[model samples]
Target: MKVKIDLEKCYKAGECYYNHPELFKMGEDGFPVVLHEEISDESLIKHANEAIEVCPAVAISLED
Candidate 1:
């Protein structure tokens, strides 16, 4: 699976990076950047799901 963020729908809320620092980080422009685009780890998947739920803009998703 891969993590995909739709910047057009993202509001730069920082929820993903703040809650899951291991999987995401704040970019220089203040947007969240995915540390791992392709995820095979169960723990990372959990974090990604958590990020998706917490994102106010609903810009985060997982793709096969």
Candidate 2:
């Protein structure tokens, strides 16, 4: 699965990047940035899911 973010739906809540720095980061424009586009690591995938769950804007998703 790959991590994808809908910038239009994002509210910059910082939950994704703050809690899962290994999978996400704060972008230059203050948006959440996906650090790893493709999630093949099992541990990382768990982190990704956590980020998705905590995103207030529901902007994060997984793409196959």
Candidate 3:
């Protein structure tokens, strides 16, 4: 799965970071940063989904 983050819509909520720190991180500007572009492994997908679900701003998504 391909993961994308809409930085413009992000409000620096940091939920993604809390849910999946390996896949998502906070930048120096306090915005969400995507650590990976694609997650094909099942284990990684689980973490990615967690990040998407926990994002309060709805800034994270799993794309085709």
Output the number of the lDDT-best candidate: 1
What would the TM-score be for candidate 1 when compared with the true structure?
A: 0.95
TM-score of model 3 relative to the true fold?
0.86
Question: Per-residue CA lDDT of candidate 2, range 1-64, in tens?
Answer: 9999999999898998888889888999999888875879899888888888888999999888
Which of the two candidates, 1 or 2, achieves a greater lDDT against the reference? Answer: 1
Per-residue error at 24 for model 3, in Å? 1.1
TM-score of each: 0.95, 0.93, 0.86
lDDT per model vs. reference: 0.91, 0.88, 0.83
When 2 and 3 are scored with TM-score, the better candidate is: 2
Error of 3 at 31 (Å): 0.8
Give per-residue CA lDDT, model 3, range 1-64, as digits (tens): 7889898888888888877888878888998778887778898888888878778888888987
Query: In model 2, what is the error at residue 30, expressed in angstroms?
Result: 0.3
RMSD of each: 0.7, 0.8, 1.2
Q: Each model's number of backbone clashes?
A: 0, 0, 0
Candidate 2, position 22, lDDT: 90
